[model samples]
Structure formats: C-alpha cells, structure tokens
Target: MAISLAALRQMILAHPKALAQGLSLLVLAAAYSPVSVLNLSPVYGSAATKLFHRYGMAVTAILGWFLKERIHEMSRGRIARLLPVLAVSIAAIQFLLFKLSSWLGSPFGPVITESFTYYPLLALSIAASAKLIQYATEISRYGETIAEHGPLIASYVVFNLAERISEAFISKVIGSTFLLTRYGLQLVIAALYAITIPSKSLVLTIPLLLLSYTSNVHVPTKHTTAVLNERIQPYGFELIDRRDSLTGYISVLDNLNEGYRVMRADHSLLGGEWTKLPGQYNPKVKDPIYAVFTMLEAVRLVETEPPRPADQDSKALVIGLGIGTTPGSLISHGIDTTIVEIDPVVYYFANKYFHLPHNHTAVIQDAEKFVKKSLASPTSPRYDYIVHDVFTGGAEPINLFTIEFLQQLSDLLKDNGVIAINFAGDLSLYPAGLVVRTIKHVFPSCRIFREDAAMENHPAVDFTNMVVFCTKAAGTPIRFRNPVPADFLGSKARETYLMPKHEIDASAFETIEKGGQRLLKAASVDHIAAFQDRSAIGHWKIMRTVLPDAVWENW
Candidate 1:
C-alpha cells in the first residue's frame, strides 16, 4: 500500500495548507529548543527565562508579522524551497555554537551568545513559518476563504503550544539526551519539505542531513562523556556522570586537584563533599565542601518547648535531599528520618556517590504534594524536626516558600517541632525579604544564620547561604543547645559549622507596616520568580569563582 511518488506529490498539492500548517509547527518547536539548551549552560542559565522566553516570544511575534511580505515574495521564488533546509541547518549550528560558552565569558558573553543562538534561530524559524502561512493563504484564496488572520492565529496557537509540549516531552519522554531529540526533529522537518516541495535542493539536503547525523547526533551520543572530559581536563575537573532528569541536567563533577566531588543541577551546585583519594586531605569522614549543608543539621540542636526527645526517640523529615548530607548526619544520630525528594536521580546519586544511609524512608515525590497528602491523612506522622532545603539554581523553589506550603510544613511538625529552611539570595532584594517575611508570618519565633561571615569589601548586595530555624510553638525563643562531641560525627565540617553563627536579625527583613511587601502564596509566587534575574546573576558569578569556566562551559 506504499503511495507512489506521483500520488504523494498530488496529495501534498491538494492540501498545501495542511502541509504548511504541519511544517510551521515543526519550525516553531525548533525555535523554542535553543532556550532549553541555553538554560543548560552557566552563561545563559540564570536569566534564560527572561532573556529567551518572555522577550524571545515578543521578538518572534514582531518578526513574524514584519517578515510576512518578504516571506510572501520569497514563497513565489526558488528560495522558498530552501527555507526549510536553511532553518534546520541554523538549529543544528546553534547547538554547536553553545559549546563556545567558555570562549564567551560573561559581563556580556550571554548577550553575544544569545544573539548567535536564539535570535538567528528565531528569525529563520519565523521566516519559514511565515512562508508556510503565505502558502496557506494562497491555497485558501482558491477555496472557501479563511479569515484574514485565521492561519496567522492558528500559527500563534501552535507557537504557544510548542513551548509547553517541548517542556513535557523533554522532561517526561526524552529525559536524558534531549538534545538529540531536538536535532532529530529538525532533520525530519527538512526531509518533509524536500519530499512535499519537489526541488533540486534535495541533492544538497540529503547529504547535509547525513553530515548532520554523523557529526552532530551520532558522534556526540557515542562519545559525549569523552568529548566533555577532553574539554574540561585542562582545569583539573572530570565529568563523572550526568543525566537529564525530571528536574534538570544533573551531573556529578569531580575536582581532581581539590579532591572534592559536586552534584550539579544545571547552573547550580546542589552539594559536594571532599573525597578520601590518595594525596588528598584525608578526614575521619567525607567532609562537606559547602558549610551550609552542615549548618542545616542545626535543626536537631534547637531546644523545644517542653524539650525535644532524644535522637533515638525522635522522627525527622527532609523535604530536599541534596547529597543527603543533613539526612545522613541525622541518621547517624539515630533519628528516624524520611526524605521527600522530587527527583529520583538526585536520591540515586546521593546514595551511589555520596553514600546516603538506607535506614530512612525515601519518598521520591514533590515536597508540596507530599505535604498536602500527608496533612490530609488521619494517620500522618508528625516529625520532631523537619528540614526544608530545596533552594537551587540561584533562586528558591517559589512554591516551597509560599505561606500555604509553610503552614503545611508547620502542620506536619509536632507541637514543639523545629524546621530548618535553607535560603540563598541577596538580603537587599525584595524577593528575599518576601520569603523571610512569609516564614516569620507562619512561625512566630524564628532565627536566621549565615553559613559564613560577610566578606571584607563585599558588594552591598551580598549573595550567600543562610538557614532560618523556626518552631511550631510560639512565645519561647528558638534557641540551639550546645553541641557535644557526639554531634560532630567525626567530620570536621560538622564540628565547625554545626553550631549556627553569624545570626542575621530576623527583624531586618520585616516589611514596614505599609511597605507593600506581603506573604508569598501560589498566586503571587511568580513575583519572586520574576525578580530572580539579579540574584541568579550574582549566584552565577559566585559559581564561576567556585569552579573554572571550562568546567561549566564544557557541560
């Protein structure tokens, strides 16, 4: 039942508008793909939402409308057949150019990189889409007339759906190696145009498609780790393992010179620890590279209303498992612990590489959903200590910081239970204040402590990690009892950072009675998300200082 070439050509000619509509969808998807890829890089990862999504959409719409006449003219000539091939070629080139992020250092590199990647891709895709729409309009004029903007409106709907569909497809279906899926889609679009349009360009398109297949898709998939390691080896870093998970691009990177390993999710470092490799600074236990994780363990030391039960008799819940540093410490202390991590890959890597203890319950689910369900159940257990440390990618997960979510966490805690929340941001920003204010609104008595001392000559907008400790019961001030030798667990990091110091005055974040700052809820969380550009940029600078440009760029 294979259709002959003549019959296929007749079918396409009879339904040019349908072919045009389908090709436009493919072109729109290609346009949105680079934004996701750019987010995987350190240079553009922080500001990508604003840089590409909000502004990229506006640019696409304006360019699509403006290019209509030019595209219509092109559609009448030889160039129309080449537009699809050119569009697909640009998408392949954009992915290749993204590897040049190391060469394009920041201050203005992201601007240049975006110019090369998203802007050109947008123009080419829009031109191709407009040409298709022109074909649709011409076809409709010979039949039942479409509305003046019917095809244009339909293309816009396709554009909007492209973003959401790609997101779901990448996260749910493709998982790892989504870059390959993107490029493959581009190739399919090119082939579709060659088949339907009937052009001599097929001579160039077939070979070019094969070349892209071997060079971009095939070779990279076969030797991705080897290629990545070769690029980053000069900086004493090694790509241990990486996967595109439901959360983001998760990687385990090792700093050979420093003898430490870090788990990364896109542009942010989740957690890391010193290794016991030869010639390295050996310790009794693998010490945490970041002191903030150790500081999270201070949840246990907080004195309760009546008084917290002994470690053996207490139960704990950890909302986020970042290398299982805090939860491992809690398990070692004999606290019955339950970890609720949204990404199973994080939990798996924590166990495989970071040696997370297996004694605790692992609820691999969203923290908010877990909280909601637990609160609904009559048999829901109350935790003596709950650790909420879900901050990542230069901004906290906005949903986790909402007043409603905080109240649920409060409900899940025993009457005297203590919750330690980790937040990373500049203190001067309104978003930071909004989060702190919301926490205080939920918990009447709370205290804040920075992981380290404020640096000398640091910028006014200091970006650092801080933990907020609060209690379910009010009136009594939240205080930490002195840690004894047992609390150290033989690790030097815990010995030093277990006691929270550098207390930030909780009252400092307090909004004035009429300052207009209010608690974050599900509806208003976007306010915090929208203002994270500065904070994320600040964090990007900090991460660059932590690891070399080559390490981030290669990934």
Candidate 2:
C-alpha cells in the first residue's frame, strides 16, 4: 500500500489552498528570521532591538497586502509566470539590507533597515516591486492564453514559501558559521543553493566546499602559559597567575630575584617592555614607550610642599586600574587608595597574578557611572591624588576622556591635588589630537610628555604613550623625581623604575589649539562605543607580536 509518486503529485497540485497556506507560513518565517536570530545576542541593546522589531513587522504587513492584491486580480497562469522574478527580487533586497545595515554601524539605524520602521518599509518596497514586475511579465508573455483563476495562486505561494525558507536557513547558517570562518560560510551557501535549485549544476560547489574546508581548518598551537612558564622560570620568575577579561589579559608574575611585578598585557601593547618575568628582550627603542606611566609617577614630584604627618592619611582615587601599577606604588607609599576597574576579570588576574597592592579598595563598575554617583553625593570624600590612567592598548574610552568627565573628576579632587592622565596613542592621528585638545579645553593648567624621547622626531611612528599632568591651579607645574631605595619593595628593579628619566616633549601639545572648534567633546555613551570596533581592530594588529596570533584567535 505504498503511495505512488503520481498520486502524491496530484494531491499536492489539487489542494491549492493547503499549498498556499504552507507557502505563506514559510514566507513569513523567512521574513522575520534575521530579527529573531539577532535578538539572541545582547550586544545590540534595547534601543537597537526595538528599531529592528518595528521595521521588520511593517515590511511583513506591506508585503502581505501586495500579495493579497495580486491573488485577487491575477489569473493562475499569469501568477505562475511571476514567481521566479519575485523570488530573485526578495533575495536581492535582503542582501542589500544586510550590506546597508553594516555600513551604518548597526543593523538598525536612521537609514535603510537600521530602524524598526525603515526595515519594513524597505521590505514592502521589495515585495511590491517584485509583485508588479511579475504581473507585467505574465501579461506581456502569455496574454489571453493564461487561465483567469485556477490554482496559479497556490503555485506562486509555494514558490514564495520555498524562497523564504531558503533565505532564513541560509542567513542563520552563514551567520553562525561566520564566527569561525567567513569564507567558509560563503562556500556553504553556494553548496546549499546548488543542492536546492533543480536545474543548477552541483559540480562547481563540490570543489569550492573542499577548498574552503582546507583553508579554514583549525590547528591548535602551543599553549602560551606553558611557553611563559618554561622560558622565564630560571630568571626566578614564577607564573603565579593569568586571566582573560573583556578588556584584555591581566597577569601576575613573581620574581624571586626581585619582588612581585604586576603586568597588564592589554592586547594592545606592541614591542613594549612587560614588567613581569618572560619580559620582552631587546625591545626596539621606537617600539617600547612608557611615557604615560612615568608621568603618572610624576605625581610624587608635584611642587606642593611635602604633606605634614597630620595630613599623611591622604586618599587616592584611580579611575582606570591597569594591573594596579600606579596604585600599587601608592599603597606602598602608605596612601589609602581605591581603584575603580570596570572588568572583574582584570581585577582578579591583576591581584592574583600581578601582585597588585592588597590593601587598596577595588570598585568594579563603569568609571562613568561611578563618577556620576560619586558626584551626586556632596558628602563624597575628596581625593588627594587622582590618577586617570584608563588607556588600554589601541583604544581609549572616549567618554572617559571627555571634557564633562574631566570636569567631574576635577570637582572630586582637593584644591591642591595633582592628577596624572595616561593617554596612549599615535599623536599624529586625528583621534589622538582631538583627545588632547579636549583635555586642554577642561583643565586650567597642563603639561604633556612622551613616555620615551623620539630619537629623530619622526611623527609617523604608529605607536607611543604620552602623559598629560593637569592641575586645577592655573600656575601648577609637575616635575620628575629620582626613585629612592625606600621606593622599591626591597628590590633593585625599583632602581630602574623609581627614577625613570623619560623626558617630556611639550611641543606636540603646544601645537594643538586650545578652545578650537575642532576640539569635539565625547558627551554620550554611544559616542564612546562608536570607537570600540575600530579601536579593537587596531589593537588586534598591535598585539599580534606580543602574543601569537593563535592566542587571540583561540579567544
């Protein structure tokens, strides 16, 4: 009692209403799939999701209306003739929306399908254009020979459903696979299309699949922890800790020969000396720059009179703690210090492995939120020294560098307070220049210094660290001090670090105009995020040499 192929075909053909309903379901599913899948990730936030959802629904409604109008007016033969053209148009529009969404920095934006409203508008246009072209073609080709109203609507519905199902399946599979290999997904899409289309040749797809798999094959590399443990163990350096954070890697290495050294490998430092064991060897002079960190140490040399024993119970606020280097030194100096670090992993690894000062307070929160909360409370204690060193690898949190942010920081500082801000970047770039200019707009008196002196003043060098020392007082100046034996934690390594002789080249800051129209302030969180993607890309390139490409790829 096996059902014959002929019988099954006749049943499918005869039940036109059932076939239409099935196709309609497929079409609706395909149209809504992108938004459905996109919602699974929390990265886009509520504003973006709302925009996508609204537009997606609108597009579906418009398309539904157009399809209904076509069903009512067109004959079965005429409708059948239009299905292929409609399918191709739908595919083209979906791809276009994807491209446009990417270009606008979001899947939901003011243009294209970036907003919830815009997406449906674009989808409706696609559906209506597809339906109209299909209708015109059928009339031009078959004319009076076409059936006025039979099962043509059912056939068109089935084809439309198939196209949508194909779209959803293709988009999801490609999207999921793209996290592994972008080109591999492209090959997979081609193969899927080859298998689905009746007349298309599958021979070419076989070779492409083979080639893509070969190219994208993942081969594990040597573990970085093992390499670090083996190479620096003889130097009396023990690999005590390592942890990865959303921001970067925070590690702690202890040297039996000296004392513990806190290291922050921020996936952005290139050719720079890492303070811990497995330290970088013979780093190119142009490559290693620590000017910002050195400037942070310059807080010790502020021209204010030495604090009396009565005022010795001073508190310090460090906004961005990287491996707790400056704050570690501050705590060692007997100053009560509190560090506000956004990433908990950074704090955990820095303390466990980097041997950061254990006595200090650790507040894990976004600096902006913390600052706002602190400012709102007038009873908040003022900090004697505020070190704003938040630069991580290639990206600086733009909001942290804004004039409004600096103003809030200034309000939180004592009248005679000293602040050292570590700004790392290529000074030649517009972004860096803009940041420097913005800082100058807020602070009354400031002096900028490069972490390392430029041998020949080549501005084109891609990497460098700079520090800007700012004071609320109009005439305050900062000077560097030699590290004393007491400054070191009973380790000779302090001799090199205590009196770090990095010279300040103030000419670059002088060249930047103050209060100029070009000094744009980063006022919102959105502004800060706009730079993250590009900054991450730049940071990735710089970090490749410090840690092997395989390490980052694994993450």
Which has the greatest TM-score? 1
lDDT, model 1 = 0.71
lDDT of 2 at 260: 37
Count of clashing pairs, candidate 1: 0
Worst 10 residues of 1 by lDDT: 139-148
**Mind sharing the TM-score for model 2?**
0.53
**Which digits, one per residue and each the tens of the lDDT, describe model 1 over residues 1-555?**
344587546655865764575565455545455433534444345454344455654676567567756755765644455555554455455446656655664435555654654555555455656555556445344334343355567667777677667655655643444443434445554555555455675566566556555544222354656766777888898888776566666789888887899999767899998885556445444789999998999898889768889999999999999888999989988999999999988998999999888899999998888898999999889999999988665667778888999998888889989999998888767877888889998998899998888777868668888899998676888878898988888777888888988998877787643444578888876655546767877777777788887676556
TM-scores for all candidates: the values are 0.86, 0.53
In candidate 2, what are the lDDT values of residues 1-555, reduced to their tens digit? 333587545654654553443344334334433433332112222223334454454556456445755553543423332333223222223333433332443333323333333233334333433444334333223343342222245435643575467545544343233331222322333233223222233343344334323332221113444554555566565555544334433345454554434354433431122443334432111111233443465576565534412224888899877666677767877888889998776777656544576888889999989888999997878888899888653467666887788888998987777787877665655556667777776777777766666667564344566677777776655545455555554433343444535555554544544433345565443533433444444444445444433332222
Candidate 2, which segments miss by more than 4 Å at Cα? 1-266, 269-295, 305-312, 457-459, 481-483, 491-493, 505-507, 510-518, 523-539
* Candidate 2 structure lDDT: 0.50
